[model samples]
Target: MSQQTGSLISCTFVCLLLAFFAGQSLPVEGANILGVFTSHSPSHLIIHMSAMKALAEAGHNVTVVCTSVPKVTHKSIKQIVIPLTEEEEKQLNAGMTGMAKEKPSIINTFKNLLGSLSMYIDKQVDVLEDKRFTDLYKNKDNKFDAVVFGFFFNYYQVGLGSLFNCPLILSWTSAPMSIVDESVGNPELIALVPSMNVAVKPGQAMNFKQRLANYFGTTLFRFIGFYLETKNVVFYDRLWGKIPDMISYDEAKKNVSLALCNSHAISEGPVRPNVPAVIEIGGIQIKEKPDPLPQDMQEFLDNAKNGAILLSLGSNLKSENVKPESVEKIFETLSKLKQRVIWKWDDLKHTPGKSANILYKSWLPQDDILAHPNIKLFITHAGKGGVAESLYHAKPMLALPVFADQPNNADKLVQSGYGIRVDLLTLEADEFKASIKELLQNPIYTKNVQAFSKLYRDRPMSARESVVYWVNYVLRHHGAAHMQSPLVHMNFIAASNLDVYAFLAFVLFIASLISFVVLRFCYRKCCGGKGKPQKSSQKSKVKKH
Candidate 1:
């Protein structure tokens, strides 16, 4: 009996010990995260959505409040879609269209967008007041550990971070521009680094015209930024009117902890300095392996006697909006080519005539299509996301930039030796045909892009991996407050050290003045006083005579 009892005791002790270790081994629950993206642009939403999905997959409960909720499979992600009104949609379309048609001058583009900026801000205010955001705000038990804001022009909505008492993160679709960099207290380096809107390469020195363009672009961007910030203060006042713990517009921006930019040095050149808070997760949308192309797409590519070409104008523009003649010219050129063509056309009825070699689709799986071994060239609108993807795939491009960053992207692609640019507005069949023929016939474009693709993909960690690592890194450290630049906390005078320099200058000036007075006094006593005595001596001599 005693032996049995001893055995039982030993077994029980072993069980208890196992249970203790097992409990310790289990992972801790992740912190809750909130992501606010008010912009209705699909491209911007993709970057933010990718981040939210990464956080959710990392065992965090993520709540995304956006104008349109993206499709996410993670169980931890909660999406709240704040839909845009019909008129707001029209305004958004108009803004893009108008900017595309703006005069070639950078200043004129900024001037045109100024009126639309206020309307965008007002729409964002509606997002903050939405029942979904209000419910989260009012719910005493609902707390978030961090908040991520889409860093479009909507700097005002960063106040959500303060309202929720959490760390704020800004996600962008491109590298940090001067305005975005300034918000995080990063150096602008206006003379060296090309403006985000310009395509000057890193190694190349800017010519007089390029320098002029960079300066004008940087100035115009800042002018618009100031106007938006000024407008934001008013909208924020109405948004935060009743809250007892109100944070000012300026204070809210300073609290931003990290900026996740969609840029990599290999593809997007002109690499410049960055603070620790700025993280580049370029090509985050790319998958480790391309998804299997649809059956029809697979068959289409397989059946092509010659290599295929993919033409996409990106998500924002409609094919119907392109002038009919321009469409006809593009088709006229493409139809002559023996290679198969796949174009992203929204309207089936408004296509650029039918051709045996051309396939028209309302939407194409762009990344997958580009990945196919048979695709020889990509004719694109030069959107940044598309540009990044094409670089990753190493496909030669023929850029037909429509508007916004497209012009800049197209210019850089040409500079990089990867492609040629044809103004979509002035595309002639002859020029379009020649550009397409050149990319296909020459091996240099293909060689340059393929070399770049290797570099772009040869990162220590993949873009998605970087995103997941940083999201958890921030959560582990409880906000990267150590990474925040001192400049963010400093006033203009203090940040520039102008006050200290002025004090030194004043002290030096005072010392110099005192030295001059002392020297003059000594000179007068030693030289001038003796001269007066000499004059007395001369007068005595005169008396004697």
Candidate 2:
């Protein structure tokens, strides 16, 4: 009896020990994470908030700082809303409208989207003053394991890192621009990687002209990128000025732990190198399984035996903004098609006009609709989110890009053999109709996109799983200081090793100068000495005679 009792005690002790270690790990797994997602666009918000949603589902206590309410939410997530006032709203819209009307280039696109110093910076600086947001850092008792900033070339968000004393994770909405690469010191080699505004086939090399354009684009990109972030130094300092354990803007940026980008390098073109600190989690905004379609729309797609087209201009560019004639061209082409149409129109009551073959809904589940087998083609503005969805579902696109990155995305679409791009501003009904017919008739579009779909979805871990693992990784490892890049710490001279080259050049110059002087001295001495000896011999001979 005593032997049995002792054995039971041993087992109990072992079980209790294991429980202690398990309990110790729970805090790391269920971290208190703070997320700042203050970009103004609705689509951009969805992409960033999706990361927070993943954290909440993983049992983290996620508190988000955002401009508007996020479409993605979780029970464990709490949001602090600091919406823009009416005046700021007008300023932001005016900035967007002004940029859209400007000339098109990679630099202009940068300013159009994430940049334009005055628009994004001034608005974000205002966030620093909002009491609701300031309260997070002001309180001494509050703590967070990490701070995930929905990045947009703005540096003031770095203040969250200092305030919370945690690892910083950046959530970028699209592929790396030169500025995005600067965040984690990820290299953006223009030779190997095309500009974000430029697209090539998945594994193709650039031609001479492409390389030349890329060089110019990359230089301007770096300048604009540096200007955009460096311009925010005043606000960054002001926000963290009096706080304890304050760090300089430069130091704060260097300490950033990771950048979770919304792009798949392999599936998307311009495949490039990445540091350990950078990860691609594109299509995280897409649902795992599509929700059921609403009744009328369900029947509409159900009976689309000839297949159907899904059209959306994205949330940022409204239907009203579209030229009335362009809208007419789109409607005219779509109405005449044998295929059915599901258009995302903002005004249901005042749609362009009635059509027997078209069903217009003010709001639609974009990805879910794309997932349907009946969805033959997607006509979009080529926004990042829409592109990800279409790629995920293997649906070809008829791109009618308006502004910002849409044109670049359109370039990628045609380049991939999946779709064609037309000028939305000058769309003709004949051209629009012909492009749709070409995509439908051509089985290559379907085959090519379908093949890429496999590459896109074939990942070691799903996007959400990666988000959970990495976020927990940072928390458990205490700010993940080891994951930082050496480049982040280096000055421009050091990063490029320009000083090393300069020293080598100086050494070569000194060595050459010494060799030249020594040769000249030796030549003069030998020649002059030989002539003197000959002259002396002649004098001696004459004297002897």
Candidate 3:
């Protein structure tokens, strides 16, 4: 009996010690994080991967649900490949390729329309309704502290966060514009308001009309995007039982708890109206040491004793689609240039000559090449990744923007005096050569770019940390209800229209009433004949006349 009692006591003591340690260790355990990145764009991929790695470093379990359409590799995060059906893949490819061609066919237009619909319904809805996602929520055993939705164009990912019943944080892979960051209270500047406009440099004040145009332009874009999102939501509601429509701004504002903009105020210049909830976390994906250049690339960079020029039209625009005239111009222009050129011409082969001055590659380690000492000028299509990388590396650029946000990025770069813009369609070989030569010769452009780079990098904290902090804030606050904008919940006209017409009507009515009263008094004074009452006959005569 004594031996049994002693053994029991020992076991009890061991159990108590284990329980105490377990309780203590529970506070620091890993958090479950679900990051939805549906955009096939490389920039979106980079930003999502960077944030995922950061969360992992902070002892969080991250699961990324992305499509294998573009085929990206992320080691730290568990990537679930959402494969596209063959027909859907063909339709999508047709849209992208067709858009680049001269005058899209009716079939291409139809395909694009179908593609958009499928993106909203088939791709997005299918992913959300998958057994893996449903099981995650239904198991009751699994829970996520937060869900990060990173996408360039699609707002539907916000639905996944709502479905998971976790804090929703939006990561925008573009500059902090009013439309996306409006909920967070950041209003884009009135481009027409010269005083409100943040000049790119001294003595370059934007006129009031220009400022107003910029403001309205951005607002219109946002409104269109919001409209499309709402339509998608309504469509989804009809198909799927009233699941929360995350695409709607009003719905997202209510459901989405946090906003993380992938931009810096400094590089984007000054925004007239700033919102507290809209956190600027630019250069979030700037890796300390990016992957090394491939062997062929290293050899080319090594051979270029003179500085090399990097020319890339980005991932979306194929070099083959470039007009033959433009191609000849670019090749001719590059041939005249003194600097060696490394062009990412994915589908092209056979150089104009054996000058060994130009090197061609299908894929290039862009960041690594930018960081190289011998790389002087970056001629690019002004995509977000290239823009961010150029800014991060302090490299000046010759921006030949093709489509979408590339034009905006290029405009900002040129307006900031950090780069020059060349219209791809109208560019001549001599003009292209001249601009490149000018940019290379000018020290101001390089100096300005480096200055911007300093400000972009000198933030209070890393962008990853900012995102993590906000995500934790949402978790700790039991949903960041306070961060949401009341405006997002209001009707579009009420929120943005500002009732200017109503105010004008009210003012006109008051003015007309005041004028009539004044006129009546004046007539009485004139017709009274020095304080004597005017006869009814005089009034009748005036009326008849």
Candidate 4:
């Protein structure tokens, strides 16, 4: 009995020792993350949610603050929903739909921005006032290791990190523009990297005129960003003035440790230098294996004997908002095709006249549908996300750009030989039909896109993996300040080297004046300070007479 008891005791001690060693070998727990994405656009929300899902899956506790919840969810994520008002939704929809129809200019764009800033501020303020959000600050024990903000010109929200005294991450759903780069003092080389609003063709060098457009476009974008940010400073003061550590929006922005941009140079070319703090996580939302299509969707694709075309104007633009004439034209063009068509229509009751070749659905899995072997062509609105996906799948496109970045995105596609662009506002059935046939019949488009797909997918790591690695890098290094650019701390004069130029100009002017004085003195000494030429005695006498 004594020997049996000794053996039991020895085995228990060995088990305890093994457990301690196993625990030591295991990975450390992930840091708690807070993601704030307040954009009303579902497309923009997807980019933010992708990152959140990735972080959560990597064992981090993520808290999301958004105007609407995304379809992508994970067990580690806790959402704090902030709903938008009816009027706000109407305004956003109107702006997106209307802008595509109107001609874009710097003046009109600035005016639109002024109008939208107030609405965006109002909507975001409502989110801040939500009880759940305030409680994050109210409960001192609710510590966050990092705060990731989905930046959409709302510079004021940087204060959230200040309130928590945590490291901050800023994400841009679109490509890196001057407005975003300037936020972190990243270089905005206008000569090389064109503004996001201006579309430059692939491999097309900018002429004086194109460069001028880029310069003005970049300048105006920066000016508008500054104007809006100044207003947000006031809003920040009014809203968080009571909090002792809350800093000005400008000051708080400097605390941003890193920025994740949804852009890849391979697809969106004219690659430029980025500061260490700016990381590109483009195509993060794209899945290695697209989600399985629904039963009806799969069946529809299987029935497409002549292949299929996917037409989606993106989530924000309701198809019903399309003019009746344009809708009929789209239908007429599709009806003539032997191929099947999948259209994303909001109002199934008023869909463009039904055809045997057309399939009408309120929503389609755009990426999944594009991935199908039968999908030969895509007609899209040129949203950055859509553009990225199409490029990733190597699917050729016919862009019917609506508004915002759509036109620019379309132009790049055309330039890249991946597709063509048609004006959606003034689309004719004949022209629309011609464009589709051109995209399908032209094998060159397919070839170019397929080549690009290889380049886009050739990366050191997947987009999701990049996000995980960088986010963890920030946490591990306590904000990774070592990687931040020195430019962040510089003012405009220092950043642009205007002060150096000014000083050099001053020195040049002073040297020129000294040289001029010395030359004049030398001339006088050489000629005895003569006012007139004494050598010309005959000419002098003739003049006197």
Scored by TM-score, the top model is: 2
In Å, residue 340's CA in model 3 sits off its true spot by 3.0
After superposition, which runs of candidate 4 have C-alpha atoms over 4 Å from their true positions?
A: 1-28, 104-110, 116-118, 522-526, 529-545
* Per-model root-mean-square deviation over C-alphas: 4.3, 3.3, 7.9, 6.0
- lDDT per residue for candidate 1 within 501-536, as digits (tens), equals 999999999999999999999999888887897899
lDDT at residue 416 of model 1 (Cα atoms): 80
Estimate, for each residue in 1-545, the C-alpha lDDT of model 3 and write its tens digit: 69999999999999999999886544333778887766655656776667777777767788877665323334556777676679876655555554554232223433454454345234655665667656666687878888887754455555655566777777777656554655454444455222211224423556666666556555555555666577656544543345443344346455767677777765455544455567677777776676777887777777787788999888756666577788888888887667889988776565434456888777777888998777889999888788889878889999887555666677768888889988886778878988998889999989998988887788777887887676666766767777667765666567765687788889999999999999999998787565443566678789998
Point out where model 1 deviates above 4 Å: 1-29, 69-76, 103-105, 116-118, 207-209, 535-545
Question: TM-score for model 3?
Answer: 0.77
Candidate 2 residue-wise lDDT, 1-545, digit = tens: 69999999999999999999997676455678888887778899899888889889888889998888877788788989889889876666666556445544566666565654256656776776789988887787888888999877576777678778888888898887666677788876878888766677888999888888888877877677667666678778777776768887777777778888898887786677898888788999888889898999999999998999999988776677677788898998898888999999988989988988899998888988999999999999898999899989999999987676788888888988979998877788889988999999999999999998999999999998888888888888887878778888777898888999999999999999999999899998978678987999999999999
CA lDDT of each candidate?
A: 0.81, 0.83, 0.69, 0.83
Candidate 1, poorest ten consecutive residues by summed lDDT: 100-109
Q: On a 0 to 1 TM-score scale, where does candidate 2 land against the true structure?
A: 0.91
Per-structure clash totals for the candidates: 0, 0, 7, 1
Clashing pairs in 3: 190-211, 191-210, 191-211, 191-212, 192-208, 192-211, 192-212
> Model 4, 453-541: lDDT tens per residue?
98889999899888888888888788888888888888889998999999999999999999999999998898765645665776878
Q: After superposition, how far is residue 119 of candidate 1 from its true place, in Å?
A: 3.2
Return the number of clashes found in candidate 4.
Answer: 1
